[model samples]
Target: MIPLAMLAQFRALHHHLLRLIDGLDDAEYRRQYHPDLSPAGWHLGHCLWVENHWLRAVVLGDDRTTRHDARYYQPQYSPKPERGARLPPRDAQLATVAAGFEANILLLADQDQRLDPTHPLMTDHYLPLFLLQHHSQHLETLRMVMTQRALSRHRHAFHPQARLRATPVAHETVSLEAGDYPIGGAAPKAFDNELAAGNARLEDDTIALRPVSNAEYLGFIESGGYDNPALWDALGRAWLDDHPVEAPDHWRRDGRGWWYGIGLEGPHELEPRAAVHGINLHEARAFARWAGAHLPHEFSWETLARQGRLSLAGQAWEWCDNAFFPYAGFKPFPYLEYSTPWFDGTHYTLRGASRYTPAHTRRPSFRNFHTADKRHIFAGLRLAF
Candidate 1:
C-alpha cells in the first residue's frame, strides 16, 4: 500500500506545480518563451501524462488511455517547438489537468494494486517517489520558462547613475587528499545514471570552496575571455563562431555598468557575492581556463560534496568537466528514454542544486546534464587545480 506520507507529498507537489502558472493568461501559458523550453501549458499537460502513464496505466494495469490529446502531451510525438501551438486553450487544458490530478490521487490511495509484490516499480513505493521527483523537476523547468518570459518582456530602463560596481570577492580553495572515494548513489530514489554506487580514484587536487561569484566572472569578461580562442575548446570555439555572447544570459549593460535581470523584479545591480549563473559548459570552461584552473571531474565534485566541503549548495548548478556517462553497472529504470538516450558524449554533467531545484532532487548523487552550448539552465562553475 502507498504510504500516507507519499500521498501527502504528492498532493503538495501537484499543488506547487499548479501554483507556478496560476497568474499566467492563455497567451503566456501557451507561448513558448525559449526555443529549448516547452510552454507552461505543455508542461502542465505533460506532467499529467507522465503520472498517468506510470501510475494509472502501468501500475494499476489500466488499459484506458488518457483523455488529453496525446500529440501535444507526449514529448516523443510533439517536438519542443511545436508543443506551444498544439496546446489547447488555457481553461480547457487546466480542466483536463484537474481531472487527471484527481485520478492520480485515487490511484495512489488504492492499496489493493499497490500490494502486488510482483511489480518492481511498486516495490518500496518507488513509483510514487519517482513521480514526485519527476514533477519537481518539471516545476524547475517551468520556472525557467517563466524567467524567459520575464526577460523577453523587460524593457531596459537604464539609469547610468544607478550603475553599481561589483564588489571583489576572493576565491578560496579546499584541498582533498588523493584516494578512491565512494561515488554514485544506491538509494531507491537515486536516478538510474547514479545507480549501483561505485568508487573512483581522485588525484590530490585543490577545489574552490565556493562557486565563482559574479565579480570574478566579470573580471574574465573584461579581460576579453570570449575573444581569446585559446581559452575555449574546439566545440566551444565553433559555438562561439555561430553565436557570440558578450556576457552571461540575462545580463545587459547601460552606459555606466552591467545589470542582471531575474524573474520580473530585476535588471537590478549585479550582486558580487552571488554565484554566476545562466552560463553553459563552454562559458564555464572558458572562465576556468582564464583563471588557470579546470572544472572538477564529476567524481571529485561528489567526493567534496559527500565530505560536506561544497559550501555553496543550492546557489547555482556547478558544471563538471567530465561528460555525462553511465556508471559501471548502469541500467535504465521505469523508462529507457530518461537517461539512456542522453548518454551521448555531447552532454556534460552539472552538480549541486540551483535555487529553484526542489529538496527531493538535491542529493549529491543526483545527476543533471545538458549540452555544451545550452545556457538557459541556471549553471555556474568552480575551479580545480
Candidate 2:
C-alpha cells in the first residue's frame, strides 16, 4: 500500500502549486512570460497529464482517454512558444486539473490495482514519489515564470523597508585532500542521471566555502568583465555578442543604485551577502576567470557537499565546469526522454539548491543541468583553485 506520508506530501505539493497561481487572472494564467516557459495554466494541465500518462496508463495499464488534451499538454506535440495560445480557458483548465488530482489520489489509494509487488514503479511506492518530485520541480518553474511576468509588466509592488542591506563577502576557502570519492549512489528517490553508484578521482583542490556573493560579482561588473574578451570562451563570446547583457537578468537601474527584481514583489536592492544568481554558465565562468579561478568540477563539488563542508543548502544553484553526462553505468528509468535526451555535451551541470528549490529536491547528488547561455535558472558560481 502507498504510505500515508507519501500521499500527504503529494496533497501538500498540489496545494502549493494551486497557491502559486492563486491570484492570477485568466490572462496572466494563460500568458507565457518567458520564451522558454509555458503558461501557468499549461503547467497545471501538463502535471495532470503526466499523472494520467505514468500512473494510469503505464502502471495500471488503463488505456482510457486522458483528462487533459495531449496536443497542448504533451511537450513534443506543442512547442513552447505556441503552448500559451493552445491552453484552454482558465476555469475549464483548473476544473480539469482539480478533478484529475482527486482521481489520482483515489487511484493511489486503490491498493488492489496500483500497489502490485511485482510492478517496478509500485515497489517501494516509487511512482508516487516520482510524481511528487515532478510536481515540485514545476512549482519552481512557475515561480520563475511569475518573476518574468512581473518584470515584463513593470509591476513594482516592492516596499521600501524590504530592501536588503549589503553584507560582507567572506573570502574563506576549504582545502580538500582529494582521492577516489563516491559519486552517484543507488537511491530510490534519485533520478536516473544520479544513479549507478560509482567513484570519481580528483586531485587535491581548494574550493570556496560558500558561493560567490553579489558584491564580488558586482566588482567583476565594475572592472569591465563583460567588455574583456579574454574572460570568455568562444561559445561565451558568441552568446555575449547576441545577448549583449551587461549584468544579470532581472536587474534594473534608475536614480537609485543597482536593484534586482524579485518574483511578484518587484525590484529590491541587491543583497551583497546572498549568492549571486541569474547568471548562466558563460557568465559564471567569466566571473571565475576574472578572479583568476575556475568553476569547480562536479566531482569536487559533490565530494565537498557530501562531507558537509559546503554551505550550499538553500543557497543559489552553483555551476560546475563539467558538462552534464550520464554516470558510468547509466541507464534510463521509466522513460528515456527525461535524462537521456539532455546528455549532449552542450549542457553544463549545476549543484546545490536555489532558495526557491523545494526541500525534497535538495540532496547533494541531485543534478541540475542547463545550456551555457540560459541564465534565468537562479544559477550562480563558486571558484576552485
Q: Tens digits of per-residue lDDT for model 2 on 1-385?
A: 7778877887888888877776788999989888878889888988988899888777777747464475667787888888877777888877778878888887887755644656888777778878887998899999888888878877444443444344443568998895889989556788899989888888999998989887787788878999999999999999999999988887665445545656556667677677888999999989888888899998899898999998754578999999999988898987898899889999889998898888778888989999888878888998887
Total backbone clashes of candidate 2, pairs 3 or more residues apart or in separate chains: 0
Model 1, runs deviating above 4 Å: 111-118, 158-169, 264-266
Alpha-carbon TM-score of each model against the true structure: 0.94, 0.94
lDDT of 2 at 359: 78
Write the residue-wise lDDT of candidate 1 on 1-385 in tens digits: 7778888888888888887777799989989999999999989989998887777667666637654465666777788887778788898888888888877787678845543655888777788778889998999999889889878887765453444344443567888899989999865788899987888888998999989888788888878899999999998999999999988887777655546546544456667778889899999999888888899998888889998998887799999999999988999886898999999999999999998898889988889999998888988988887
lDDT comparing candidate 1 with the true structure: 0.83
Cα lDDT, model 1, residue 332: 89
